[model samples]
Target: MVAITDKEFKQLTEYIKVNYGIHLKEEKLMLLTGRLQKVLQQEGFNNFTDYYHHILNDQTGQAVVTLVDKITTNHTFFMREADHFYFFRDRVLPFLANTVQDKDLRIWCAASSTGEEPYTLAMVIDEFFGKDKVFWDTKLLATDISSQVLDIAKKGIYSNEKIAPLPKHWKTNYFKKHDNENSVLIDKIRNEVIYRKFNLMDTTLPFKKKFYTIFCRNVMIYFDYKTKIELVNRLYHHMEYGGYLFIGHSESLTKEFTKFKYIMPAIYRKE
Candidate 1:
């Protein structure tokens, strides 16, 4: 087992947080050491310090991009947390569909990891509006810290296993067999989502307008308290009045954010 001392640990932690919004805890050095060792070795670097030096010296930042890609937890699938979609359909969508002027609905899937979550949202929107009544402006901004994942997401293809939990109707209706093993998101639904790279630490976001719903789920568990607080506040500011925030089942904004009233768990509304 490779041991991580304080010096190498600090270097990598700063590198990760600076490049990706993920803040590594002191206890997580083991995790960093283990997960990153292979990346370093694969690149012919001896250790984290060498890797850090390489990234620091690379002005073009392709090295940092690769490191962020290697470190980001992009493991996700379509229709994850069926209950959230249930909440969206039963609780959230009806409100947006009826109350919001025009049939346009905008959902931002922050930290959209490999496109599963946003694609799932698009599928649910498709179901709600029916296949024929598809409104053109029903869009989703699928953003992640890793450009590499966003690139893959923009292609809108997934293995059958990645979409295993989709209902039979959705599986047949929303996707087509790309080959013997994978499925591609049908053109209509895939076109509704726009994939882009974003950093959570940036004080200003790229969006000119706010969204009706934002899903930043499962991405905050790695951040420190200060970073978490800043991110939560920034997300709060980005939402329109009555916009809904859905986070991971394991995450909560209770520690730092008091503006949001906890709606269930992993769900909050700007109040």
Candidate 2:
């Protein structure tokens, strides 16, 4: 495998950081080479420099999408962070239920990778409202930068092992076994989540309605401090007053830089 030269590494990493807010450190050079080398070879690129130029000069932007799909890590699973779901069901949903006069609950899963997180949210909401769900609008908006993942998310199918961690009730209610024994999310549940391709680094959020809750969990670890702060502020502006934001359990927002009130570990509220 050809190694990424220092200059090539800088070019690629800087491009990623500036365009995607993903901070690829020097240590990730080997990883990048491993992920991207095959694409370079298949595309008949002689070296990293050529690949870099192709990425920079490609007019269609499809090249960048392919690059992002290959390089960005999208490792997530059902109930990966269980606490946030619990808090959303027990606290956030109830508050929205009582306060939102229109009976519409706007939820955004900003980094919904392979459908688990948003599907789980939909399940919880379904269970929460039960017979009363007909009166409320609980459709969720799930977005990710990679169309590859979004395609998988839209299909609403998972390996048995992938769905194993999901609650038994959820599994029974929301999924059905395909002939191959893989679990496919039932249309009723699958249709509740509307998936879209979204790049977080876009300067402005174009949504007409502010969300009551945003689940952007585990994605910010790839971003540098400034990017994260700016992203957080943008999120705040796009959320309704008293809306909730859920981040990764391992992530935190510096109180000094953010307008959100720290509600608990991995959770914040707009006040």
Instruction: Count backbone overlaps in model 1.
Output: 0
Question: What is the C-alpha local distance difference test score of each model?
Answer: 0.82, 0.93
| Superposed Cα RMSD, model 2 | 0.9
At residue 69, give the lDDT of candidate 2.
Answer: 98
Off by over 4 Å in 1: 1-5, 131-136
| Model 1 lDDT at residue 227 | 81
Inter-residue clash pairs, candidate 1: none
Error at 187, model 2, angstroms: 0.5
lDDT, model 2, position 227: 96
lDDT at 241, model 1: 81
